[model samples]
Target: MSADRPELDRCSRCGECRAVCPVFRETRRETDVARGRLLRYRLARDAGRFSAADREAFSRCLLCGRCLEACKAQVDVPALMQIAKTDSGFAAGWPSLLTEKTLADDGRLDAAVRRYRSLSRWLGRATPDDSGLRLRFALPYLDAGRLYPKPPARGYLEQHTGRRASGVQKLAFFAGCGAGRLLTGVGEAVDRVLAELNLTAAIPEQACCGLAAWGIGATDAARRTAIAWVRSFAGEEYDAILSPCASCTAHLQTRLPQILAGTEFAADAARLAAKVEDFFAWLSRQDLCFDLAGLKVGAHVPCHARREVRDGAAFVSFLKKSGAELVKIDERLDAQCCGMGGSFGVLHPELSRRIGLPKVAALRAAGAAVLVTNCTGCLWQLRDLAARFDPALPVRHPVELLDR
Candidate 1:
C-alpha cells in the first residue's frame, strides 16, 4: 500500500460498496463515493494530479465507514480518509471551529457549560406566556426547537469520582466531547449503569478521542489531542476504560493503540484497548437487569461500531434481556450511513440530510416508540431528524434506556 494513499491503494475498486453508500445513492456521482475518492486520492498521490478544489472534495466525506462494511475487499475507509486528510491539509470545517472554540481550552468549555446551565434554569422558570419564552415564539432561529426530555443536568463524569466504588472491577469514563458537552443525559446514564455493576469509574479530564480531528485531516491536531489525553491519564490505572460514545469507543479501541504504538504511552493505549468495553458488551456479560417494562425500542448501530467492534448487536441482546421489545430496524443491520458522520452533518447539511432520510425511514418503519443508538453523533442527528419528521418519535442513547 502507498504510504500517502494506503486506503486508495487498498480499495479494490470492486464497486461492491456503491449499493450501500448513501452519498453515492444520493448524488450518483462517482467521486462522491469512497471508491472514486480513493482512486482520485491515489492518482493525486502518485501523479501529483489533484486540483485544490478536488482536495476539498476529499474532506467533504463523513468518514462513516459504511463503505468499509460493504467492502468484501476489507478496505479501511476511515483510516484511508484519515491519510487523505493528513496528506490534503483540510480542516474539519465547522467542527474545526467548534473544536477550536470548545476543545482548544477545557476552561472555556467549563465556562460555556456554566452559562448554558444558567440559561436552562432561567428558561425553566418562565411559562410559555412569559416575556422571555414568548420572545422566541415568532422567530425561526430562536425557536430552533426544543429536545425531548430536555437534556440532562450534568455530564456523567461530573457526577462521579475515581473513588466512588470499592469493588471487584473499576472503569475510567471517557466521555467524548459530544457526550460531555452535547449529550449529557447519555453520559449520566452510563454512570448509573456503572454503579449498578459496583465498578467505580475515574472520570478523567481527557481530550477528545481524536476521531473528529483525524477525520478532517487534522493529523497534527489529532495526535496532539490524543497525546494530551494520554498524558492526562498517565498515572491512572483502572480495570478498564469505557465509553457510551460508540465512535469514540471504536477509535479508542482500534486507532489509538496504533497511533501510540512504540511511544511512551503505547502500553497505556494497549491497556486501554484491552479494558475498553462498549456499554452494551459489558451489560451483556453482567447479571444486571433493567426495569424496561412495556418499553418498545429500536436500535441503529453506528457504522464505526459495526465496522470496528462488530459487537453492537450485543445491544439487541441486552435490550431483549431487559424485557424491552427490540424492534429490528434493518434485517442485516448494515443499512447505509446515518448521514451525521461525526462532523459531516455540520459540513454538508443538505447532503447529510439527504443521506439521513433513509435511516429515518428505517426507524419509522420499525414502528417502535423510541429509537436507541450508542453513538453521540448518531443520537444528535437522529434526534434532530425525529423532531423534523415527527416530534413524537423519540431518539435516545441506549444507556438512557438502561438507566430508565
Candidate 2:
C-alpha cells in the first residue's frame, strides 16, 4: 500500500466505523464498512489497479460521513471513496451519465421534469392527501410502488426569477434542484418565512448545486455545474446566500470552493462560499415567535447539518422554542443518514431502503405526529418511507411549520 494517499494510510483499521455504518449493520459485511473500504483502496493502490470488485466496493458507500465523525485518526473516507470511484471509472456508466447530462443543463433538466410531470399525470394515481402520485406501473428508473413529490407546474426559479423583496439587508436564495423543481412548496414556505421576518431575498436563476454529480465521482461535470451556479449569483451583491436544503448549504459552503480551486471562478466561489448560510442556522438567529402549540414534531437531522453546517442543535432548540412537543428517539439515530444520498437512492434502492427503514421505524415507534428534516433529499426519502409506513404521517421541511 502506498503512503502517498495519506487519507487511506491514516486508517488504523479501527472498527468503530463498523458499529456506526448503517449498511454494515444490515449486511454485516466487512467490505461494507469504511475501514474495510479503506483497506481495499490501499491494496488496490498498491497493485496500481482497481478491480471491478474494488469499484463496486467504493460505490457501495452512502457518503454519509459517519465514519469520518467516528474515526479518531480523522481519515476522510468519503473523499477517498470519490477518488477511488474516479480512478476506477465507476461513474462513467449509465446512471452517472444520465445525471451528468440532465443536471448540468438547466433547460434540459427542466424539459425532462416537465415530461415526467406530464407522464405522471397521465399514468400515475393521485394520493388521497394530494402529496404526490403513486405510480401504477414501474418505469425504467421509477418503481411502481414509489411515492414521489409532484413537481410544481412552474418551478421556483421559473416563476420567481429576478423577483426581489424590500428589506434592510440584501439576501439571495439558492433553491437547489429539490426545492426549485420537485417540491416548490418548500421554496414558497421559505419566502413566506423570510417575509414574516421582515427580511428580503432575491430569487436567482440557479442550476443544480453539483453535489449529486460530485457524489457519483463525475468530477468534471460537477466542476462545470459549480462554475455555472457560481456565475448565476456572482453578479449580485448580497449580505448572504441562503439555501433551505442542508446538503446544498453544506456543499456550497464547503465543496464549491474545492471544486473551483485554480479555475477563474475560484475567487468568486470563495466569496459566495463565505456568504453561504443554512436556513436553519439563519432561522435560529431570527427573533420571531412560532406557534406550533400542539404539534408533535420528529426531527431528523441531515448528515451535512451535523458535520458541515453544525446547525442540528440550533434547529432542535428552535423547535423547542416553537412550543412543539419533541418526540424522542434513540440518541444514536440523531445524525444517521436517511439513505437519500442523491444518486445512491437511485442506483442502490434496496440498500438505501435497508438503511432508511430502521431510522423511519424508530420515529414511527416514538409516536411522532409529523416528521421534519432540513435537507430536501431527506425530506423526500422520509416522505417515501413515511408513506409506506403510514400515509397519514406527513413529512415536511422545518420552514413549512413557520409558514403555517
Candidate 3:
C-alpha cells in the first residue's frame, strides 16, 4: 500500500522482471524494466537526484504490473515508480500534457473531438486513400483521415443519464471515458446486457478515469480527474459501481483509494473503491444465461483483468455456462496488454505495434472469428492490430458478444 521510494528497496534485482515487462520485452532497455527502474529510482533517491533525464527513464514504462506479478519480491514497481515521479515533481513531456489538459476538461475534449469528426467526414468524402493522407502529430490522434476511433459529438453521459431498470439488485455504471467517448457502441452494448439480465444500472456522470494521465507523469491532472469522478457518483445509491473498461476498473479499484489516502475525500474514495467492480467480473457473478450454440469465441483477457485475475475464473465459468464453444488462445497472450497503453500507441505507435504483434498472431492462430475482452483500450488496440496484421479478426467485448 506504500508508494514511497523505500518500498522499492525490496527489489533484489533478480532480473525476473525483464522476462515479463512489456516495455523491456520490446526495447530490452534496463531503464524501462521494473527491477532496473526501481534500482534507478532508489539510487536517485539516495543521491538526492531527480533530473529530467532520470525522469524520462522512469516515465518510459508500461506500468503494466507484469513485473509485480513476476517478481518473487512482489514489489509494486508501477506504484512506486509513479509515486516517485510525483514526489520528485517530474512532469510528462509537453505532448502528453497538452493532450491530458484537453481531456481533463469535458467541453474542450468534446470540441476537440468534434473537429476530428469534421475532418474525418471531409476525408471520407474526399477519396479512398484520404484515410492515410498526412499529419502525424498524434494529439487526440487525427492521423490523416483515419481517426483511430470515430468520435461523436456527444459522449455516452451526454446522451444517456440515470437508471435503466428497477430491481432488488442495483449498481452504478461508470461508463468509462474510453468507451463513452471513442467506442460509443461499447457503452450501448453494456446497457443492452444489463437490461437483458434484468439488472438495474444507474448511469453516473464521470470524467476521465485518469489512468491515461496517470500512465504518464501527469499527477495533477490525474488527481483532479479522480476527485471529479468521486464527486460525480458520491450520492448515488447502488450496491456496486461497475466499470466496463478494465483500465477504468483497475484505476477505480486500485489507484483511487491510494490517491485520496489522507485527503478529505478519503472516505468517499474508499467507498467507491469498495463498490468498484470489473463489468465482466460483476456480470459473470450474476445469474444470467446465454446459448452460444455452434460458436467458437475466444477471450483476449486484458492485462488489468490479469493483474486483478481473481475474477478470471468466475468469468470463464460464466462464459462456459453460456453454451459458447470457448477457445482460449494462449495463457501468455491472454495475460498481456494489447499494446495500447492508452496514449502509448499514440506516443510510440511502432513500439506499441511491435508489442502487440504477438498477441495479434496468437489470436489469429486461435481461429476464433470473434475475440472478446473487457478492456476498451485492449479492444481498440486489438482492432487496430488485427486490421494491420490480420484483417479478418473481429474484436469485441464479452457483453457485446453475449448480447448478440
Candidate 4:
C-alpha cells in the first residue's frame, strides 16, 4: 500500500542508506542519494512545490531497494518517488510520459521498433551481434563502441504456437518484455530446459511488466500495463506462471497485487501474483541434477530480485546440487545493485555505467570466466560489461546451463 498510502513520513533522514545505495555510491551527489531525495520530496510535498528538477532527482534513482533494506526507518523510497511521475502531476515531463505511452500502447511499440532500429543506425550506433550485444553509446563514460542489440526476427511467444503444452505440471511462461522482444533466446533456453525435464510451459502473449513505468515513477501507466497483463491471461489456468527474468518475477509477486488494489482487476492481480515463483527456486525444488564438470561460475544477484525473491539460499542450494564450483561476489550477498536499474540507465547513463561496471570488473578480477544470474536485465548488463571490460568472459542465465 506504499504506492497509495506513501510512507515518506517514516524517513528520519538517518543517512544509513548512504552506505548501501548503488546510485549514491556512484554519484556521491546529495540529489542522487536516497536520504537526500526523500528529504527533497518531503520538503516539496509539504510546500506544494514541484519542479522539473524534482522529477530529474526522482528518475535518477535506480529503485534497487538497497536503501530500504539498509534504512532503519524502512522508508518506501521508490513509492514516494512514484508520486512525481504519476500523470496526475501537472505535466511532470513529456518524454517520460511519452516513453510510458509507447510501452502501454502495443501497436505504437511494434511500429516503433523498426523506427528505433533505423534511428540507431542513422545515429551510427547500430549493432547486429547475436551474442548478447551491450549497446555502449558514444558517451564519454562508456567505452567507445557501438553495441545496440537487435530484436529477434520473431519473438518467443510468436514461435510457440501451442497453448496446451505436454506436461503434468502446466506452467504459463510470462516472458517479460525484454525476453519476449529483445532477448528472445532466453525464452528458447527456458523452453529447452522445460522439455529436458519432460515439461512444457505455454508462452502466452504478455505486456511489458510495468516495472519500467514504476522505475520512472509513471504509476498510472504501470497500473494500466499490469491490468492489461492480468486481463490477457484471465481465463487461463496453470500450475504456476514463470518468467526467467528476475525483475518480472519480483514485481508480479511482490508489488503488483498492491498496484491493482481497489480496481476490478485486484482479485485477478492477486490471483496471478500468488501463482508466480522464482524460476531458480522452482528448479532447485525439482531436484534436478546439474553436471558442473569442474566449472566455476561467478554470480551476480540483481537488486530487485534480491529484495523480492530472496533466492540466494535457493540458488546456492541448486549450485551445490549441480556440483559446480561457485565464485560468488561477496558484494552481491550484501545485496548490491547491478546499476542497470532499467530507466535509471537512461536518466543517468554515466552513473549507471559507473555503478554496474565495477561489479562486472570485480567478477572478472576474481577470476570468473562465466557469470550467471536469474535476471535478464542483469544478464544484458553483465554481458555488456564483459564485452567492454573482459572480452573473453561470458554471462548466462542460470536456466541456460541447467538443461541436459
Candidate 5:
C-alpha cells in the first residue's frame, strides 16, 4: 500500500473530479469523491488502520478512472482505491473469496452460470421479446425487475473450442465471461465479422480476465486469474490476442503486466499485453465495408475503453466508416458511465441505477434506433436499462451491426 502513497499524494484537491464522477454527482457526498477518499487514505495510513467509516468511503467508488482523467496532477485514484481496499483487509472478505474460488476457475465459473440458468428457468418469467428473463420475486443479489439475458443452450467456448478458421495472421480469441457465456450472440457476431474478412481466429481456453477481481481490491485473486490467463495464451503462435470485451482487453493490455510485474511470468505477461487488442480497435483498422447506412446507432463507450485502452477515436472512426448515423445525446450524458461498474451494480444497485438513468433517458430522447456498446458489462446494464426504460429500443454489440 505504501507503493501507492506517491500517487495518492499527487491529488491537488482541485475538485475537478466533481465535474465528471457519476457517483459523486448522484450522492453529492464528499466521502464518495476522489479528494475526500484520498484524504481518508492519508489519515488511515498515519493511523495504521482504516476505520469503519473510511472502509465504507473506499467502497463507494466506481473505479471508472474518470477522476484520473480530470486531475491535472494525473493522480491514479483507481489504483489508490484498490490499494486502500487491500490495506483495509476488506478485499479478503466474501466477495473477493467468491471471485477467487469461482471466477478464477473456468470449470466452477461455468457450473455456477449453468446453475443460474436452471434457476432462471424455474422461477423467472420470460420477457415479451424472449430476449431475457425477469424474476417474480427478488433474490439475494438479484432484483425482481432486472432483465437477465437468456442463457444459450451452449456457451461460445463450449461450441467453438476446437473450431478453427484459416487466415494469414495467427490470431487468438479470448471470449470473456459475458460473450462466452451470458451474451453468446456477441461472440457469434465477432465470428461473423471475422468471416467477412476471411480471417479465422483461434479460440483459446480461457477464464475471466480478472478485471472484476482487481476492481474489488482482490489483488491476489486478480493476480492468480491473470497468471492463469497468461498461461492460457503462452506457447501459442498468435500474432495478436483479441477480446470482444473492452474491459478484458484493456486489463490484459495495460494492467495485467503490472499485476505480474515482479512475478516469474512477467515477461510473458508483457509480451501478451503488447499483442492484446480490443475487437473494435482491430476491426476498425481492417478494410471491411459494413452496410449500416442510415441506421441510427447510439454508442456507449465503456469507461475502460475510454480511459485504459484509449480507443474512443478508433470506436468513433469505426462507426463513421460503417455509414451509421451516430445519434447525438446530451453533452453531459455523452461518454458517461452506463453504471455497470462490473460488481458495482451488484453492490450498490440503487446508486448504479441513479447514475445510469440519465444516460438511458438521453439516448431514448435522442431517438436512437438501437444502442451499441462493446463491453459485456455495459451491454448487460444498457440492455436492462433499455428494457425497463424503452423496450422498443434494442441493445446490440458493435460487431453485430457490422456483421449485419
Candidate 6:
C-alpha cells in the first residue's frame, strides 16, 4: 500500500497548534504537539534509534482530529499517527477487560444496560431524563443524580420498520458502542426522531467502530474490526447508515472506506460510506418540529465533527429553528476539547483535566443551564468535569432537546 507521505509531511513545523492543542496546552512540551511527534518519528527513522516510548507517545493521541483542523495544510494527523501505532507493538494489547469481554459477548452489553435501568427504576431514581449507561455499578461515582429516560421498550426504527423490515428508505442504525451501553436513551431518541421521518432503522449486532482501537495505535485491529463490521452489514438492502454518535458517523464516513479500499469489502464499504449520515444532519433535513423556547443552550462542536462536516453550524441552525436560544462559547486560547478526546482521558487523566478546565469554565459562564452537543465523549468528559466543578449544568444531546 502506498503511504500519503506528502500530506503527512505537510506539517510546517509551526508550533501554532501547540498553543491551541488541548493535549499540548496541558503538557507544554514540544513532543506533545503534533509537529513535534511527527518530527521525532522522522528523526528516529533517519537515526534508527526510535524507541518504544516514541511509539507509545504517538499512541497516546486522542485522534480527535484537532491538529488537522488547526493545520493550515490540513495534514491528516490521526491517519499518520495510526500508521505509526501500527508499526509499534500497540496492536498487541487486548482491549480493556471491559472492552474485551463486551466485544466477545454482545449480550453482556445489553444485559448490563437492562440491569442498570431496572435497578435505577427500583431505586425510584430512573427518569426519562437520564443519560449514560444506566449501570448500577457506575451509579456511585458516575450517576450524580442524573436521571435518564427509560428506553422505549423498542427502538424507534424497530417500531416503524417492522421486525422483518423492508422499506423504501431503509436505514442501518449504527448504535455506537457507547450508544447501547452508556447512552441508550440517546440512541432511542434517535430512533424516535427517525421514525417521525418514516425511515426504517435496523440495528445489526456489530463490534466496536474501531475508533478507540485506532486512537491507541491498534491499527490492524481497528482495520480488521472495521472490515468485519462493514462486511457484516454490506449486502443488506439499506439506503443509509444512520449514527447518533459523531465519532461513529465520522469513522463510517471516512476510516472504513479508506481501510477497505481495494479489498472485497471496498465496494460495500464505499457504498455504506456514501450512505452514512450524522444524526444531527438527518434531523435538520427532516420535517420534525419542537418547542424549545424556554430553554437556553450552548453547543460544543466536536473537533472531528467539524473536520467531517464543518463547524456544525447547520445543526445549531436546526436547534434554533426548534426554538432554542443557542449560544456559542468562544475560545480565545483554544477550541473546546472538553478533554474527553476519547481515550486521552484514560491515558492521561491529569493532563486531560488541565486542558479541559478552560472549556468547562466557559460552559459555566455561558449563563446557559444546559450545554448541548453531539459527541458522546464530549458529554462524558464535560459531565465528569461538571460534577467536579459545577454539576448544576446539564450536558445533553441536541436531538434529546428536540420535540418528537
Which candidate gets the maximum lDDT versus the true structure? 2
Could you estimate the TM-score for every candidate? 0.84, 0.93, 0.86, 0.88, 0.94, 0.81
Candidate 4, TM-score vs. the true structure? 0.88
How do the residues 11-106 of candidate 4 rate in per-residue lDDT, one tens digit apiece? 777888888888777678988888888777777766767787777777787777778878887887766676655522522443553345666655
Tell me the whole-model lDDT of each prediction, alpha carbons only. 0.68, 0.81, 0.70, 0.69, 0.80, 0.65
- Residue range 1-404, candidate 1, lDDT tens digits: 13544445677778988877777788898988888888777778777555776666675677777776679878877677667666665563434433453443455656666665666654443322101121223221122242212334664445543334356976677777777765557666776777777765777666577777666667666666667767656566777677787888887788878877878878877776777778787778778878786887867878777778637557877888778887666654335667877656755666777777666767677767888888887877777667667667877877777765
* Lowest lDDT block of 10, candidate 1: 127-136
Candidate 1 pairs with clashing backbones: 85-217
Worst 10 residues of 4 by lDDT: 139-148
- Error at 14, model 1, angstroms: 3.5
lDDT for model 1: 0.68
TM accuracy, model 3: 0.86
For all predictions, the C-alpha RMSD in Å is: 4.7, 2.3, 3.7, 3.3, 1.9, 4.9
Window of ten residues with lowest summed lDDT in model 3: 125-134
Please list the residue runs of candidate 4 whose C-alpha ends up more than 4 Å from where it truly belongs after superposition. 1-6, 87-108, 117-146, 310-313, 332-334
lDDT at residue 225 of model 4 (Cα atoms): 82
Residue 129 lDDT, candidate 3, scale 0-100: 24
Per-residue CA lDDT of model 3 for 1-404, tens digit only, reads 12565566678889998887888887888887887787777777778767887776766666778887788988987778777667556644545434356655666666666676677564533312211222334334433322255455566766876545366777788877667766566778777777776766777655677787676667877877788788878876678887887778888888888877889888999987888887767877677778877767767667777776337435555666778777756676677777776655665677778888787787667767777777877776677676667666677777777777
- Give the residue spans of candidate 6 off by over 4 A: 1-9, 47-49, 93-168, 198-200, 310-313
What TM-score does structure 1 among the candidates reach? 0.84
> Which residue pairs clash in candidate 4?
135-147
Better of 2 and 3 by lDDT: 2
| Candidate 1 lDDT score at position 394 | 75
lDDT of 6 by residue, 112-212 (tens): 55665566555543322543323334332233333233444543323322233345577777776666555556776776676677765777766567676
